[model samples]
Target chain A: MRYFNNPEALLRLVSSMQEGFAITLTIFFATLLFSIPLGMVIALLRMNRHRAVSVPVSLYILVMRGTPLMLQIFAIYFAVPMLTGHNLERMTATILAFSLNYAAYFAEIFRGGIMSIPVGQYEACRVLGMRRSQTFFYVVLPQVFKRVLLPVSNEVITLVKDTSLANVIAVGELFRAAKNEASRTASIEPLFVAGLFYLIMNGLVTLFFNRLTQRMSYYRD
Target chain B: MLEATHIRKSFGDTRVLKDVSLRVSRGEVVAIIGRSGSGKSTLLRCLNDLETVDGGEIRIGGQALVTMQAGQPVYKKDGERRALMLKMGMVFQSYHLFPHCSVLRNLTMPQKLVLGRGDGEAEAKARDLLAKVGLSDKAGAYPCQLSGGQCQRVAIARALCMDPDILCFDEPTSALDPQLTQEVLGVIRRLAQEKRTMIVVTHEMRFARDVADRVIYMEDGVVVQDGPAQEVLGDHRSDAIRAFAGE
Candidate 1:
C-alpha cells in the first residue's frame, strides 16, 4: 500500500519493466514475421494431393495444436539441448516454440480460407489461360486474405496473451518482470501496470488489423 | 473453328456426356440447348479444356487440344495445350468475375499476366472492350457493385479483351432475372452481329432461335437434333425437340 501510494515508486516500476516489455514485443513481432509465411507454406502442403506430403503436415499441425504451448517451450529449451548437446538461448527457444505452435493454427485458418473460394474462380482463371502460379498468387490469394481476416485477428489477439507463456522458461518477459516486482514490493500494483502494457500493445494490433479490414472493404462475395 | 468428336465424359458411374460431337465453322454462332444434366455445359467445358474428356478428340482452330489414344483422351503437352486453349475465351453463367478486382482489372490483369501485354496495351484493350459492352463508366467499380446483368456484360467484355478466335458462353443469362437477361442477350446479339465465332450453351429458346446460326439440341447426353436454328426449333419431325422448343 505504501509503494502504491508513492507516485515516484510507480514511475520507477514502469521504467524498470520497459526492458521486459520490449522483449515481449520482440517475441510477438518475430513470431508473426516467421510464422505467417511458414503457415502459408504449411497450408499448401497440407492441401497437397499426395498423402505422404499432406499426412505428415496434418500430423505436425495436430501435434502442435493438441499440445500445450508451455510444454512446447520447455521441450525446445531443455529437451532439445539434451538431445542435441547444444544449448539454445532462452529467448530463441521461446520464439521457436511460439512460432511453431502459432503456425499450425494459422495454417488451418489459411486452408479454410483457401478452400472457401468457389471452384468457379479457378475455372475462370483456367479459361483465361492464367498460369497456375499466377492464378494462385494473384487471383486466389487476395480473396483468401479477405476471407481469413477476421479469424486471423482472433488468433493474433490470442497470441498477444500467449506471449506471456514465455515466462515459464524464465525468458525475462513482461509478466516475469511484474511478478518479480510484486514479490519484492508485496503489492499487486506492478502486475496491474503490466496488464495496462499488454492492453496498449493489443490495442495497436487491433488498430492495425482494423485498417487492413477497411482497405479490403470493397471486396464482397 | 472448334470441333469435338465422340466426346465422352463420366462422373464415376454416371455418364454425363456420351459420344457427343460438334463442328463449328469460323464466325458461326452455334447454340447448344438442352435440359439440365444434358451435358451441354460439359461439352463446352471440354472444348475449352476446363474439363478433360474421358474419351474423344477436341480440336480448336486446327490445333488439337486433346486426341484419343489407347481408348483414353490424351491432352497436348502443357505449353501446347495452353497456347491452343488461349485461342478461345469463355464467359460463365455465374459471371465468375474476380470479386476482389475492379471491373477494369478483371479484364486487364488476365491480359497482362497471360499474354504479357504491357500496361498501356492492356488498359487500352480493356477500355475498348468495356465500351463495347457499354460499361465504360464501370471500369473503376468492383463486381459486387454491379447488377447481375451488368456483371455478365463485363464478363463478356473480359473475354473479348483477349481477342479470342472463338468465344464460348456457358448459359450466360440463366442466372439473371428476365429483365436482366435481355440486357445480357442484347450484348450477345451485338457480338453475333459482329460475326464473332461463338458457341453458346443456353436455355433461352428465343435468343437461340434469333441469334444462333445453327442449333444443336441434346437429350440424355446425345445430340437429338442438329440443324439450322429455324429448322431445329420449328422441326415438326421430332416430338421431343418440339416439346423442348415449347412448340
Candidate 2:
C-alpha cells in the first residue's frame, strides 16, 4: 500500500518493465506467426495416406505434447548447444521451443477442424474443376479456420502466459522483470502490476477472437 | 457432346456399373432414373470423372477423358483431365455449394480460379447466372442461409457460370420437398428451354418425363431401357421400369 504513496516510483517500475514486456510480445507474436501455418502443414502431413509420412508426423506430435514445456525450453537452450556445439541465444531458443511445441497442439486442432468439414465440400470443388490445392486453400481453409477458431484462441491465450516460462533460460520477459523488481523493492506490488499487463493483453486477444467468430457466424454447417 | 461407352465400375467385389454406355448430343437433356443402389448416380459420376471407370472410354467435346489402355481405362493426365472436366459441369443431390461463401462467390470463385476470368467478368457472369436461376436477390447470402431449393438453384448457376459445354445433375432435387423440388425443376426446365446439354440423375419420374428428351432406366448397374422419354416412361416394356414407375 505504501508503494501507492509514490506515483513516481510506480511509473518508474512500469517504464522499466517495458523492455521486458517487449520481449514477451516478441515471443508471443513470433510463436503465433510461425506456429499457425506450420501447424497447417503438419496437419496435412499427418493426414497423408502413406504411413511413412504420417508416422513421423505422429511421433513429432506425441513427443512435443507429451513433454513438459519447461523441460523443452531447457533442452533447446542447453542440450542443443551441448549436442551441436553452437549456442542458441536465449530469446531464439525460447521462440524456437515455443513455436515447435505449440505447432503440434495447433496441428491437431487444425486436423480435427479440417476433418470435421463434410466430404461434400471436396466433391463440389472437384466437380468444379478446382485443383487439389485450390480445394484446400480456397474452399477448405476458411471453413477450417472458422471451425478451429475457439480452440486456437485457447492455445493463443495460454501462450501469452506460457511466454513467462522463457525465464528458465534467463530470457528477460515480463514475469522475470516483475519478480526481480518485487524482490529488489522488497514489495509484492510490482507482481500485481505484471498481472494487470497480462490481463489486459489477454483481454484484447479475447475481444479480437470474439469479433472473428461473430464475423464468421454468417455460415453454419 | 458427351460419350461414355462400355463403362465398368466396381466397389470392392460389388460391381456398381456393368458395361454402361450412353451418348448425349450437344444441347440434349438426358435423365437417368433408377432405384437406390441401381448405379444411376454412379454412372453420372463417371461421366464427370468424379468416379473413375474400371473399363470404358469417356469423351467430352470429342476429347478423350478416359481411354482403354492394356485392358484398363486410363484417364488423361491431371492437366488434360482438368481441361476436359472444365468442359462439363455438375450439380449434386446435396447442392454441395460452398457453405462458407456467399451465393455470388459460389458462382464467381470457380470462374476466376479455374477459368481464369477477371474479377469483374466473373462477377458479371455470376450475376447473370443468378438471375437466370431466379436467385439474383440472394447473391450476397451464404448457402447455409438459403433453403434447399435456393441452394440447388445457386448450384445450377454456379455450374452455368463456368460456361461448360455439358452440365450434370446428380439428383438435384432428391433432398428437396415437393414445393422446393418444383422451384428447382423449374430452373432445369428453363435451362432445357435454352438447349443446355444436361444429364440429370433423378428419382422424380414426372419431372424427368417432362424435362428430359431422353430417359435411361438402370437396374443392378446396367441400362435396362434407353429411348425417347415418352416411349420409355409412358409405354415402357420393361417390368423393372413399370415397377419403378409404380404402375
Candidate 3:
C-alpha cells in the first residue's frame, strides 16, 4: 500500500502493462491457435513412412526440437528473413519465432499420443472399411487428442511464460514494459508488479485448460 | 455367400495364418475358436482385409476380395471394401464406441459418413438403433461415462446403424467382466435371433456352442474343425480341439 501513494499511480502502472499485455496475449494465443494444428500436421509428416515425405519432415522437427528454443528464436528472428528477404516486422517476427518454436514441441506431444494409441483401433477402423484418411481422422485423431491434452497444455503454459523472451527482439511484451517502467521511475517495485502479472496470466491459462479437460473427460481415448 | 480360397499371413517369420480358408452363407453365424496364437483373430481380420493376406483369394457373395475389386467374384473385400464395410458391422474386444462422440452421435457417424444418410435420417436411425440396444436413455452420454456393457451396446448400435449385412465380433466378451459380458452377449444373441450374419472370433466356448450355428476351429492358422456348433463343441473329434476344450 505504501509503495503506491495514490490510485492514479496504480492505474497508470496497470495501463502501461496493458499495452504490452495485449502483445503478450496475442503472441501466446495466436501461437497456440496456429501452432497446435501446424504441429499436428508436422507430426503426421514425420510419422509418414515414405522417405520422400518423412525424411525432410523428420529433419525439420529434429532441427527445431534438438536446438534450444532461445537459440532458434534468435536465429529465426535475425537470420530467417534476411536469407529470403521477407523483412517481417518486429512483432510479426517474434510471433513467427514463437510459433515455430512451440510447433516443434507440440509435434512431439502429438506424435507420442498418436503412437500411444492401441494398434487395434486402427485395425478396427480398417476392418469397418474406413479409408486410410478416414481412419486417421475419425478413429485415430480423437484418441490422440484425448491423450495429448496434458502435454500440449504444458507447452501452452510454457508458451505463455515464454512470451517474456520476445522482449529481446523489441516486441515490447510484459517484461519489456516492466523494464521501461523500472528504468523510467528508477524503482524495482514495477518489476515485481510485472512478475505478479505473469503469475496471474499463467493461472488464468491453467484454469481455462482445466475447464477444457472437464468438457472432454467423456472421451477416454 | 463368402468363400476364402487360401488365406495366409505371417508376422516377421512368425506365421500367424497358413493357407486358411472357409465359407459362410448370407445369413450364417460362424464362430471361430482356437488356442492363443492360433490365428483365430487374424483369420477374421484377413477376411475383412484388416490384415493384408500374404497369399489368398477371398470372395464375398461371389465377388473377389483379394484386391477389393468391383463386380466379378463380389470380393466384398477389395474395391468393395467401403460398401462392404458399410454392409458389415464390427465389435472389438475393447468396445470401440468412438469415445469422442455421444452415444447418438456414435451411432450416426457411420450412417452419415459411410452410408451417406442425411442428418435427419441418420438421427432417426441412430435413435432407433439406440432403442434397440436399450440405450436410448443414455444417448447423450459419452463412452467414458458409460459402463463397459453400455459402451459395448453403443458399439453394437453404431455398427447396426449402418444396416450391415454381416456383423463381426472379435472376442467381444474377452475384455468385459462376467456380468457385463452377459449384457453384451445377450445383445449379440438377440441379433443372431433376427437372422443377422455374424462372424465371431472368441475364446468363450460356451457362447460359441450356445449361439453359433457353425463353428470353425483353427490351429496355427488353418481350420482343423468345421461343423455345427454342437458337433464341433460336443462331438470334437480332433485331438487338438479335444485338447482345446479339455475334453
Candidate 4:
C-alpha cells in the first residue's frame, strides 16, 4: 500500500518487473525451444509398439500428467539429487522439470495431430517413393505442426504464467523480482501490478498465436 | 507391363483378395468395376504394392512387390521400394495433396525428390501441366481452396510431374459433384488420347463405357467380365455383371 502512495513508488514497482519479466521470458522461450523437439521424440516413443519404448514413455506421461506442475517443481528441485546422489542448481532443475512436464502433454498433442491425418497420406508418400524420414519431414510433420500449433500456443501462453511458479524454488524470475521488491518496500500493491505484467506478456503471445493460426488455417480439413 | 499371380490379402481372419491374378500389358487402360467393398480398391493397392499380399506376387517393371525371386523380402534394402514406386504414380479417391504446400509446390516436390529434376525445371513443367489440365490460373492456389474436380486435376498434374508410365486411379470421380465429374472425365479422356496407360476403378458406368480400352467387371474379388468396353457395358454377358450394371 505504501508503494501505491506515490507515483514514484508505482514507477519503482513497474521498473521492478523488468528483472522478473526477463526471467519469465527465459522460462517461456526455453520451454518452447526444448519442449517441441522433446515432445516430438516422446510422441514417437509412445507411438512405438514395442514395450521397451511405449511402457517407459507412457510411465513418464502418466507421472507428469497425473501430478500438478507445483508438485513436479518440488520433486525436481528436491528429489532428483536424493535419488541420483548428485548436486544440482535450482534454475536447471526448474527448467528440467517444466520441459519434461510440458513435453508429456505436447507429446499427446503431437500424437493426436499425427493420428488425425488420413491414412491415405502415408500410402501416397509410400507410393511416391518418399523414404520414411523424407515422408515424415515432407508430409507428416508439416501437418503435425499445423494441427498442433493452436494447442501448443495455448500451452505456451500458459507457460508465460507458469514461469511465475519458478519463484517457489527461488529462481529470481519476474514474480520473484516483484515479491522481493514488495517485501523490501513493505507494499502489497506490487503483487497486483505484477498480475498486470503477466497480462501484457500473455496479450503479446496471443497475437503471435493468431498469426500462427493464420498460417495454419490452410491445412485444416 | 505389370503382372500379379495369386495375390491374397486378409485383415485378421477376413480375407479381402483371394487368389487374385491380373496382367496389364504396355499401353493398356483396364477399367475395373464393382460394387462397394468388392475389393476393387484393394486390387489396385495390391497392383501398386501399397498393401502387402499375404500369399502372392506382383511384378512392376520386372521388380517383385512382395518378395524377390530369391524368396527373401522385397524392398530388402533402403531405397528399393522408393525406386519402384517412382515408375508408377497412384491417384487416390480423395486428392491427397500435401496440405501445407501450394499447387506449384505440390507439382514440384515429386519431380525434385523422385525424378531428381531441379526446382526451376520442375516449376516450368508444372506450369505446362497446369495448363494441360486447364488449371493454369489455379497454380498459385492450395489444394483446399480448389473444388473437388480442380483438386483432382491438380492431383493428375502432380502425378504427371514424375513422367510415370503407369497411372492408377481409385474411384477418381466418386467424390466429385456431377458437373465436376465431367471435368475429370475430360482429363481422363485426354489421357487416353495421349495413350497414357492407366488402371481406373470407378462406379461411374458412363466413364468406363467411354474411356476404357477394356473393362473388367469384378464381383466378389474376381473379374466376372473382361472384354472391350462396347461388349462389356453394351449388353454384358455374366449374370454378376448384369446385376452389377443394375440390369
Q: Which candidate has the highest lDDT of all?
A: 1
Query: Which is superior by TM-score, 1 or 3?
Result: 1
Instruction: Give the alpha carbon lDDT tens digit for every residue of B136-235 in model 4.
Output: 9988888888999999999988888887779999999999999999999899889988888899999988889888988888777666777898888876
Among these predicted structures, which one has the highest TM-score? 1
TM-score of chain B of each: 0.97, 0.97, 0.92, 0.94
TM-scores for all predictions: 0.98, 0.94, 0.89, 0.94
Runs in model 2 deviating more than 4 A are A1-12, A185-189
Question: How would the docking of model 3 be graded?
Answer: acceptable
Please count the clashing residue pairs in each candidate, in the order shown: 0, 0, 12, 1
**DockQ of the candidate models in sequence:** 0.92, 0.79, 0.49, 0.68
- TM-score for model 4? 0.94
Ranked by lDDT, the better of candidates 2 and 3 is 2
lDDT per residue as tens, model 1, A122-189: 99999999999998999999999999999999999999989999999998999999999999878888
- The CA lDDT of each predicted structure is 0.93, 0.92, 0.81, 0.84
How far residue A11's Cα lies from its native spot in candidate 4, in Å, is 1.2
Residue by residue across B111-143, what tens digits does model 3's lDDT show?
Answer: 776667899999999899888888889988878
Candidate 4 chain B, poorest ten consecutive residues by summed lDDT:
B68-77
lDDT pick, better of 2 and 4: 2
**Per-residue alpha-carbon lDDT of model 2 for B142-180, expressed as tens digits?**
888889999999999998888889999999888999999
Residue B159's lDDT in candidate 3: 76
